[model samples]
Target chain A: MSGAKRGGIEVLSGNDMCVEGALAAGLSFFAGYPITPSSEIAESLSSILPRRGGCFVQMEDEIASLGAAIGASLTGRKSMTATSGPGYSLMQEHIGYAAMAEVPVVIINVMRGGPSTGLPTKAGQADVMQAAWGSHGDYRTAALCPSSVKECFETTVKAFEWAERFRIPVTVLPDEIIAHMRENVDTRCIAEAKPFDRLKPGKPPEEYEPYSYEISKEGAAIADFGRGYRFHVTGLAHDATGFPTNDPEEISRCNWRIIEKVEIARSAFTWTEKFMLEDAEILVFAYGSVARTAKDAVLRLRAAGIRAGLYRPVTIWPFPASEAREVFREARKVLVPELNAGQMAGEIEKYLTRGCDVEKINRLDGEIITPVQIMEAAKALHGRKKAQSSD
Target chain B: MAGRRLSPAIDIEKYLRKRNLPHIWCAGCGNGIVLGALLRAIARSGFRQDDVAMVSGIGCSSRLPGYVDFNTLHTTHGRAIAFATGIKLGRPDMHVIVVSGDGDATAIGGNHFIHACRRNIGITAIIVNNYIYGMTGGQVSPTTPKGSRATTAPFGNAERPFDICLLAAAAGANFAARTTAFHADKLEDLIFKGLGRKGFSVIEAITPCPTCFGRRNQNPTGVDLMNLIREQSCGIEPGGKSEAPAGIRLGVFADRDEKEFTEIYAEMAAGAGR
Candidate 1:
């Protein structure tokens, strides 16, 4: 069952687009386990990757899936894995391992309602905070939120780019709504986009150091195994030579580099989708599936002669704080409409300037927040603003 | 066993990272001897240094990877096999070997170990079964003897220990063998044979953690533990076709030709032309 397409466009679900995006980004290996709302990505890659001379493995479990992906990545293959909330939780340890060992891997989490397997088949965006700090210890990696099917593809590619560029695990967060929703995706631009490759050791194998703290200058540049550069890789704190170390100075240097690499490259990959924000007093902050609803709500509010604008942070982590500060500068009031109970609203509150009232509309009962709910929240926010102005 | 040559004629020093030593194993730990056997096996194997990847999980035995100079990866606890599985699948041409402790392999990493055997991928798993979690201060592990004393089981363990070789054989590994740190020559020979095999091969090397395990047990020294291992083990007779004895037997428990996992995947990948 497929929809009609014009030119280079094809109808695909968000998960299907993730597969397409991974292929476009030179994904050479994939190991995954099936989970709700994210199974299609693994199923599609199983048939496609092998055909394209890439490798695919359905690992024993979620933990093994990411463990295998990390191993494949060490061999200079662009590797990835997909999962839902519970599976993502199981992958947290390896996520930390990948970060500590400086392995470039891409993980796609199709967000579902959960503290523990809450609603597997339904949609939710509650994994936003977990995406940032789920794994223990300090490490920075890009987490991208794609609102639409086309962005699902583009954002998947972007995730790979940042993973390779920063030599760290990058996560693509797509809520269950976007994961299952099908739409016609124009893939011409994405197809032609050049994929980023991880930096290889340019020096002789004898002098090559697999890790270093040149965060402002370069990301992790490593040599693939079997290429004659037999450097050690470990999850423990390590020195520039890639061997484990206990020296306090060396440990500090290693930790700071992995965290700062993403911060240094933030300007290049950080992005936001703004709709009619020039002189708007009420700013609507949202992302993922909620962002799409927010857009609809913003349009309706504008049609009703109220200045409401939608601001969606495409790159959710390395959290666009500077841009949030700039965008929230002119707004008198801000409204966050999300699936979770104020997960990202609290983050938005962190960046909003003084005197700006932040209102949150949360729905956690396995349902999407409708445009009407957002419009009502915006009206209330506007009424509060008017009352304050009159006083 | 009085005058046996534990060290091989090959230059194992070339295989070691001299700067990283002296190793972190305890004063009387048998891990050093096990590491010596592994080095001899690797030295005897025909594979080039660059083509071998030594992966280990967190443990005293896992620290052996750091001392050697191959493409070593000291990963998180209980994930060395999973990581080695990926490396083998990624580069079928590379010789991937995993070194994990008893608790790391048979407990936390049990699922991956059994699955790897079922898949029959070409990975040599040298499970250093010290009977307890030596790195974590002598906690009773999956392979700890039912009546053994550990820090976690001070009153003696009630849980039965696992026959790791039998477990590997039952899980469908192409090759499964058993030897001890005291049988250093046999340990090296078994490891070499495991490396030469086509699919998933397992060698459970019973070694001693004198500091953790032996301190609480009757055997308080490495020499005492070595003598205890020597006395308990029985060698398999040549041309024996009977089932393995219920106790520890020092020989190959299983060996058969099987279609390897990586080769099947490689064939499919090659056939799936762009």
Candidate 2:
């Protein structure tokens, strides 16, 4: 790890980075019910936030925690809630509400092994799929993954920014490893970050349609609450006016627009790191803590004269499909290693398996995929391919 | 039930959303009467429609938010008061009202209710205690009177019901009142006082669940439920000594002025340069 200071910025752990990121994003309220791995986010906020003119509430349960956070967001304050797997499951309904109601809130899901309470203290990237589709309905959601402690801070800040700009709930999907890992993070990276504010209605209150989308040069515009702009927000499909509308035509238009807003703004939402892929014959795709192992494996493979590269996705939701396709198009084979049983691998196959050989190395036993395991997988694939060519 | 009448001068219709008609409430349900009382109080208090925010958790009574023409939030089960606390803190200018049912408020949301009371946020909570979980069938609720037969407790309820008003009083609510839907006029008066109070206030309205609690408890008609309320309730005069009735107690049990949570928070913030 780097020393306590980097480029005039103080070094910190991933959990401390989350706290710094939250503060940098101008979060004024945190309502959370603590669970393992994710509890430090709430604990840090409870101590630091009140001293910084913000409020931190330990709600009775995960459901109420998200509820209070959504309530706080509606009042024009940047609000957030943090939880692990079981708690994340409890928050799914409110997450849908925040999406439908266009409430700006950030949810940090520090994942653990689960279908339900599977492993409380262990790390797992099992929630990648859940973060995208856990909430009911056809809605556009954003989930960002941070591999290192520095990225944990930076991604949390980005989550709040995107939530405010898009007027939707954003999730910082960190697994237990990154959430609990100690690393030196430069907080000054956040100091230079620009925050996005909620879009205010341009017209008078009487003429303003709360959910009405005006395609600006930037993107879809959002109307902030308490700006005298009144409209109904329901969990049901609604028209541009935000009133519940069952009309299929209106619903289709609104639904498509919801998708379009995130789709068209993909460039701004995507984050990735490409290593030694220019002349590489093999590409390893991974994310979260698995990406960290993959990076080490790639370095080892390069030292062994086996030209291999690594592609790490920082934003897992819009699933870096296009970039993964581009990277895989030139490679002879692509390897995907994840904590879950091929969730992201399935998504990668949807986009990147045109003609290249695709392979998956999965572990569901609530243990991190070690660097040696990744290197072994790569070597096994290489030996098999070399044997086939010799035959 | 027909003999009593509220003032015709009160325009209760103004607070209603006419397009969202054909309400989900059962026919002859006293929830309509309780809704009327709340509207009357809002009208009488002279609060601007824009300045009022009604929040509710999931239940038949919690559906009150969808019917009201105000800044409303129909939230998840048992979390209305927590949501209301956020709204009150976020917009101190708005008159925040939390309408919930027994199951929604006292069961799932009981902790939030007690904490909100303990914080003493300047908000009014009107708990429509129908003594049954009406939305999800006649399930035994936290406020289901002991020995009553509910779907969950088919033989008979072994658990004692929570007296919500007493809980609020114990939790440091500045104002706490208990009334039934039959007493619409008095319900409105207490609701108005709660709305005007500077600290956390609770008005527990003993409403009728005609489809659930009523049918299961052998009171099939809404009028029969109203009669039960009338017969069981006895008045407790404000600040005067009184004796309890045979069954449920009626009227405000406690009312006092105290520093609200927001005021104290603001003062503390100001002291700390917020």
**DockQ of each candidate's interface versus the true one?**
0.80, 0.42
For model 2, the docking class works out as acceptable
- What TM-score would chain B receive for each of the candidates shown? 0.93, 0.95
lDDT of 1 by residue, A113-222 (tens): 98797999999998898888989999887789999998998899989988887788889999999999998877675647688888887789898888853675356577
User: What is the alpha-carbon RMSD of candidate 2 to the true structure?
Assistant: 3.5
Native interface contact recovery, all models: 0.89, 0.30
Put down candidate 1 lDDT per residue, B71-92, tens digits, no spaces.
9999988999999989998999
lDDT of 2 by residue, A29-74 (tens): 8989979888888988876666667777777788878888887777
RMSD of each: 2.1, 3.5
Candidate 1: segments with Cα more than 4 A from true spot: A1-7, B1-7, B236-247, B270-274
Error of 1 at A362 (Å): 0.8
Q: How well is candidate 1 docked (DockQ)?
A: 0.80
